[model samples]
Target chain A: MLHSFTIHRAAALLRAGEISATELTAAVLDRIYAVDNAVKAYLTLLPEVALAQAAAADAAIAAARAAGTLADLPILTGIPLAIKDVITVAGVRTTCGSKILESYIAPYQAAVVDRLAAAGAVILGKTNTDEFAMGSSTENSAYFTTHNPWNLDRVPGGSSGGSAAAVCADECLAALGSDTGGSVRQPAALCGVVGIKPTYGRVSRYGLVAYASSLDQIGPLAKDVTDAAILLGAVAGYDPRDSTSVDLPVPDYVGVRDQGAGDRGLHGLRIGVPREYFAPGMQAEVEGAVRAAVELMAELGAEVREVSLPHTDLALPVYYIIAPAEASANLARYDGIRYGLSAPADSLWEGYRRTRGQGFGAEVKRRIMLGTYALSAGYYDAYYLKAQQVRTLIKQDFELALQDVDVIACPTSPTTAFRIGEKVDDPLSMYLSDVFTLSLNLAGICGMSMPCGFDAAGLPIGLQLIAGAFAEATILRAAFAYEQATAWHKQKPAPG
Target chain B: MSLTIAEVEHIAELAKLGLTDAEKALYREQLSAILDYAATLQAVDTSAIPPTATGLPLRNVMREDAVRPSMPREDVLANAPDASEGYFRVRAVFESGD
Candidate 1:
């Protein structure tokens, strides 16, 4: 139960001297030891490092209490959190779930990691991910596929699969995941936890290894909306280290909702129901769960209306084209000459060829090739350029719809978590899985996924909430309201 | 635009990746399928739309040109596959048409 405590609850106990950071961290480490064998959520577990941090947090908390500075204690003090392997943690191995960086230790911490450390959070370790954050399932990881906690046979949706699974299984209190093309939201949905992908520049991308630089945003995966909000607040800010990070102010997100309204949750909040998201071919049970959530929003004193993101159908192709094109360039840094796996050959060209050829996995190669082909001569205008134009239309579609609504509601994924290798071979089919969530990234807006219901198989289905750029407070408030009104977030997976 | 084995191989070479024969065949199949599916973009008339490199509006992100501390040489070379004299060492490329 110590591992299950939310940030706010844990903070109160730690402040009152009822529970120490070491005790909570040990509980989480034990939980990971007990469950990670079946779940396979973590790529690395830093027991020694985590215990040292826990001890540091305890000392800091004690010093603050004794000095009458307890009021200024960091909210995340003593909380155990997981970092996705893609985010560098200085001396920790930042594998990004690829063989190329299997032995790669980052030279510096990410801006978010620095912020979290300043807040006194304990890092559990690196969680597994799709190689370079490219796949819908962790199956694409050169390391290992992270199994769903609900059912070991199924995958936790990815490339943030390990992060979501860790949060859901209580391997750690919460986790950070990069949301590029629904990586965070989809996995959080599958694992039955809350996940938030802040507005594109809301969180700095300083140390997240670039995979589609334009689309990637570091976000939080936690047991509930409040915890996600806490973790989000800890990292959401402008950093001079990242050029693209917004100069806009980061509000007190955890306290944002508490000021506005009374018990009539989401009153005067207009929730847009994007009709295209509930289009044909989607799973019946998934649509049913989302529809039920919409109806519940209506009952909770929200004005709900059907809206449209006309470019919804084009999101998949747009994402595939644009993401790969960017990834193609982003991943080019891994040559035998630099940090990471290097295969020496007779010449420089051969070294580049062999190192990349041997280091990258099949899906990574497929994407790289697809990206190269798209950006190649005689095809750049046809594929990559057109996808960019359509991307504008997609952003326009969201902007048009959002003008009339505070937040848009949709399903996180078209379906629940699938079997491990179900659609990996059919690349297009797998790409379509993120149809509902990809456009938000394309629009550079805020979105989150929280549990709405369970399928007949008892798999978790996610309800997605979308808001305009830097509107995390609105999304957080609306989500917290719905979360408070429902028992769905209370559901936990059976022991794996 | 179905990609042939030659096309796949060409792309692989351009990307500095050496694909095995079987991988080239598989990529020819998969990449072609993906490319063919991606051709749907041609149906949309995007003449009026400007391409978006990122969802962020175009702006020259400038910072004060101030010198700052950098990573230590040891830390910089920590993960290098081949390092000599505190620098990344690579194979010679004597006029191999980069």
Candidate 2:
């Protein structure tokens, strides 16, 4: 009943009338009921709403079959999906894992949510995240922490931790998550799910609660590469509402999926192994796993080469500066005057003070203060401006490296998931968790993390695939080939 | 060591976050550690580099100044915590502070 059905298998089953959408949705819902108590992945669940959507999908499949419109369609019809807390789903609470927005119900759906609905995916629930999507671990969630499905004692990476955990636990067939500095990919790697962070502006940020505006892009968390591709095809496109949304034409992601790795799969594909990515501090097991994945690609006919992104070491400091600076500005709207939490006080200043004081979590408040200081009057030139300059150098480094390679491969995180409270008290260590993946975001490039191997403790380690801007098809093809060759992606966590 | 209480308060004001004296002391310590760590950026030598604020090279994306449709006032105020006749109601800012 709980085999890891790839998107293709699930779609075929639904189309053949062998499995009703209602039955699939009920199964996932039952799984959630069975395991969510231990994982705490979902912030909210909508069983009735999901069941209704599933029934509708079943009817649509029947009607489409009768009308002969069922052939050559988008893949994800009748699939149940979970959404990150940061992405708004109209009429659902979009807490963003913060006390500030704990009671806030989005008046409108995020553009990604609208597209997912259009693709006939059922909305199962909203998942938890770090407050304001500001932390690397879901431990910063003001309400609750999403436990790693592999081992509940460890963390599911954040701010997409809950989304990854939900998919890992089989609570949902697929989920949508946003990545800013590896938020989506890191957790996906930690939780052993396929997480894709589409190139900046590849997917619309219209209703995504802003966090590092230019750096944030919405993508998918799925059980496999095919599902991630199907979900990305549905959500990636231009949107007039978002000024930063790219007008580039969305590619036929499903076409790329069906093409698979063919004879030329990884043949002649120039894969760059960045020296900075394999620096001295990376965990030995992680380095071993990444090397094995690279070797596998080499055996598959890819020409592997050593490359240097000289400015790569600067990515972490630069990202922390710029992301927080933008977040400080983006989060300004959540003042006491708007919806969400508001603490009553005698005067307007006092009210604003009390509201914000009680609303934001400790880590969020720390980041906001840090960001505000960086962008403040006198310090702007020294901190924020310098970081921006370094960011350019980092992007240039990627551009130079891409000249020699079509794609780059590395470990998604320095190590696998750590214990829940391990890095919560140390901000620097937590920030460094995204070291390998941050450069891709700064360069506005697409990247994905696929299950490559497991740590000594049996925790999954993710191997990252990064490509130049708008090279998602190539990245997905390579990941698909690797996933097909390895059975790591198929492993599931035992229910507690 | 790097951040003073006054600097912390100044930053708190900029962020619109209120802090108690005790919290201010805590931030002074936390901010000191963070600022010291962030000091590593100073070694990068970006003296002649241009700041990159966005990925796209395009500039001047301004729209034409033309009249456009607007949302109904009722719809605009639908989600307001408190709304009065044609406006958002809020706690009075001042009763003549001077």
Best by lDDT: 1
Distance (Å) between predicted and true CA of A280, model 2? 2.0
Please give the lDDT score at residue A142 for candidate 1: 93
What local lDDT score does residue A368 receive in model 2, on the 0 to 100 scale? 84
Cα lDDT of model 2 overall?
0.87
Clashing pairs in 2: none
For candidate 2, write residues A332-425 as lDDT tens digits.
8876665778788888887777888889888878888889999999999888999889988988888899999999999999999999999987
Model 2: CA > 4 A from native = A2-4, B62-78
Candidate 1 chain B — worst ten consecutive residues by lDDT sum? Answer: B89-98
Candidate 1 global Cα RMSD: 1.4
- Going through the candidates in order, their DockQ values are 0.82, 0.64
Task: Report the Cα lDDT for residue A474, model 2.
Answer: 83
